[model samples]
Target: MTQTGSYLYAIAAPVGDDVLGGLRGVADEPVRAVRHRDLVAVVGTVDIGPDGPFGEEALAQNLSDAGWLAAVARAHHAVIDGVARAVPAAPLRLATIVADDDGVRDRLERWQDGLRRTLDEIAGHAEWSVKVHAPQPADPDTDPQPAAGAPGAGAAYLLRRKAVATARDDALARASAVAGQVHEELARHATDARRLAVQDQRLTGADTPMSLNGAYLVPVAGADAFVATVEELRERYPDCRFELAGPWPAYSFVTVEEP
Candidate 1:
């Protein structure tokens, strides 16, 4: 037997024909509305065959599979990319499928005004991510002193180790102070800012410890200015590594409307 799924495009306010014309879903499918009184859910049809993107077995397999995870991520981006061009949208979590159109309508009814306001607020803005990494300092190789009698040498060695640890701690504290300054300066230019969990140094390519991993929502007109501000920041903080990426879909900023 063949199964089916509702592929959500986005949750948006009730829009006119002109706005709907500009929106598309997976595979360039024209967006259609499933209305629930005050709110509307834009969606397209998706197949749920054995080999389809959201098939029951396929979903289960992705629970532990890296390749499956990547494919799903791409599919999600494609859908969001299309709709965001036309409307202020809150892209749902990946694979947020429902049984059919009725289920989509039910969600719209439950979250109407919150969805409307979220869409209005985000219209014409995009999300950008920036992170700062503090590079690891080169290890200072200290020679171990030989013990005179051997039995009491362990106690002396520990004392020397403690002194070295104290010095390193002082250095880390200074670096952290510098990082804080950078975050504060950058926050001044953003409409909204959020500090994300520190990513691994290896992934971030920062020389110092990661000082900041943050997301910002900036107006489209201010995008160039935002990039320029970040460039100036990079020039100002030559001692620290600054990594910047995005103009991506507003993943972190979007939230369900509250009653």
Candidate 2:
């Protein structure tokens, strides 16, 4: 028989039983709450046998499988996202597992203060994602007609190449400057901002190069205005492509132990 472990999804302020009703977590197990003092931990039972997906040895192997990882991640996020909709919850890192309910309570007791602070910090805020991509500048047109076989022709060709390279660099610098301005303007409308590494074109499958990958923490009351600002920036900078996604749980703003 497979041994079971508790998969912790999130720590939240006290929540009603209905909040967990109809929710299925990793392994399709029903999610339940374990309360300790003023906090509740949302968890579900998962197998921890040597061959089971959540087992220490098996988990490392399973993470290498993209399809399996995606399905499990969706289930984990689904549970926390559902709870966040009705209460202030701090999501645990993906794959947080313990021996059993007693272990979960012990964690709650140990981390209650930090968890409470995190929940308070994100109580009425949501994370917003914004990406700005700019088309790569075209290479400078070169007139390579330097009279082949003529004196100094080789030197002229080298000069043209250098000029072309310089022009491209300058154009990229200008585009980078514009991206900075956009981020600064958008930051004005948010409570907090985080700049993420820009994704590669191959991964994004975008024809243009990304200039900015940013996440913002915005109050619910200001969500509409924040979205409007994004649209306005999009129009103001016609050269850049803008992507906005929002009203999500504050995943980027919280810090939790992954191990």
Candidate 3:
């Protein structure tokens, strides 16, 4: 016999049947709420056996398939985004699965207290991401001009390398100081702020190295102020660049861990 399950996306205040009826989740499964009192778990139907996309075996196989992973991730985000509009919600980590409706109920029951508290904390707020990058110094080897009346080849090459190293270190120190000030300025407009480890240049497709990657939880009403503050930072640090993205659902603030 084949077993079936539900993939849970988020938990929130009671979502009406009408609200759930209009949406679909992963695999185009209709979105629905499995309610236990005032708390509701948003779920989508899934097959749990080896043949299914979300199955234990299938998950491992698909992890490296970028296209498949992107599609599933987008689907998961869609449900959470829609739910957030109707009610304050706490989004679960991607690919959270339960054995059945009963399992969904049990998980919700265990998390009921935390869910309520999380909802209250996130009420009327959203998340924003701010990233700052420090420009890379020009490669000394690119020019490689021997200093006036200096020795040829070997000595000149060593001198150029040392100069490049010194410039790179100086740029990094300046960027670090600028990043700290930028974070402090942005935090003034946010209810909560976090400094995340900087992402690699390869991942960010950044021309320069990332110096600061921060997420902020800002009140919905104050979103404009938060963005304006980020803009101000850009002007303050013209050498370093900034990327501000959001009014995203409060993903950074939802701290619930699955039991």
Question: Which candidate's TM-score is highest?
Answer: 3
What's model 1's overall lDDT?
A: 0.72
Candidate 1, which ten residues in sequence have the lowest lDDT sum? 133-142
Model 3 over residues 148-257: C-alpha lDDT tens digits?
67778677777887989988987788789988998898888888899988999899888878999999989999998888888878887888988989878888889976
- Per-residue C-alpha lDDT of model 1 across residues 20-56, encoded as one tens digit per residue: 6665554345667777786667777776779775688
Candidate 3 accuracy as TM-score: 0.92
Q: Supply every candidate's count of residue pairs whose N, Cα or C atoms clash at under 3 angstroms.
A: 7, 0, 0
Q: Which stretches of candidate 2 lie over 4 Å from their true place?
A: 142-164, 256-259
RMSD of each: 4.4, 2.7, 2.4
Give candidate 2's TM-score: 0.88
After the best TM-score superposition of candidate 1, give how far the Cα of residue 145 lies from its true spot, in angstroms: 11
> What's the residue-level lDDT of 26 in candidate 2?
81
Per-residue lDDT of 75-123 in model 2, one digit per residue for the tens? 9999999998899888888998999999999988888778878889899
Model 1 bad stretches (over 4 Å): 13-40, 47-53, 138-175, 202-208, 257-259
Could you say which candidate leads in lDDT? 2
Clashing pairs in 3: none
